[model samples]
Target: MQNSLQGIELFKASVSISHQENCASGTCIDKNLLENYPPELIVGFQLLESVERSGTRRFAIHCGSADNQQHNGLLAWVFNTDLRYSFKDTSSASRSISAKCAMKVFYKHVANVQPLVNPDLGMPSVTSLEELRLPLHIYHCIKTVLEKSTSLLPPSGRKFGEWEIGLLDLESA
Candidate 1:
């Protein structure tokens, strides 16, 4: 979707601007400063698991601050392929839930809903979901996951479900 793609670009731009600001200070960047950049400016998403039943493909996404070094948590976004809808769940839970459970719940909630155009999509367009690849932090987290799987998961006590709805919340700004 155009909105989601625009949001991904906005996030990248915001981080670039922040990095430039840090460089302009004429001092070595502090790890804490880099780690503590506003979480809202560091959005990222990963396709955790997907399922296809009938002719539809439903997927679960974990999206949140891309700064894995920080204690921030992730929000869950579900693509209800059967219903042709995307729904976000902002419920607070343990910092990390089993991917199996996440997939189960996501599908369960969306399975019974009637197929309808996503309200978030606004007016119809020529865009196809197959052509839209959501951004994910491969170099950052995947590197850590390969080296030490635990290193990439959120800290135990961090609050989940706190991410702002990307870009949509900024429309009025």
Candidate 2:
């Protein structure tokens, strides 16, 4: 309920104290948050964002036929995010705009953690985002930190089949 997901809060309190900790997102609800939201909502959010960044509209339509469509995209997205982090806005490079976009959405939705590059450390570290990693990792990190926190549903409940197809029933469209 607090504005921030405090790491110390999660660590100090026993999970059993709140049924909240049992769910993937760690939000307190009468039932599991996974059961609270519709699958389409999650899928739609992801697919729409994906299409927006890539400027492609066929990914979801052909998703079923493509092998490992979603999985590959995820790996690629992660790679791209890493690349973008390493090199911001470099021209003539295989610029990972998709990853940057996803990370933006992710940071906005999950934990409200802003990415900061400390001049002293010379690397990035998430202050609030750390609290979200556990439930997300348990939930297979399907949605980014922002999506998990702000979105109505979590990734485990998302239904990809209903979307307008793209490349291989992957729902990239």
**Candidate 1 has what TM-score?**
0.21
Candidate 2, residues 14-88, lDDT tens digits: the string is 132333455666554563333322322344344455546764332211111112222211211111121122223
How do all models score by TM-score? Answer: 0.21, 0.21
User: Which tens-of-lDDT digit does each residue in 23-73 have in candidate 1?
Assistant: 766466655545333222222222222223222232222222332222221
Native-vs-model 2 lDDT?
A: 0.28
Off by over 4 Å in 1: 1-26, 36-77, 80-127, 130-173
* Per-candidate alpha-carbon RMSD to the true structure: 16.1, 19.2
Which regions of candidate 2 deviate over 4 angstroms? 1-35, 61-173
For candidate 2, the C-alpha RMSD (Å) to the true structure equals: 19.2
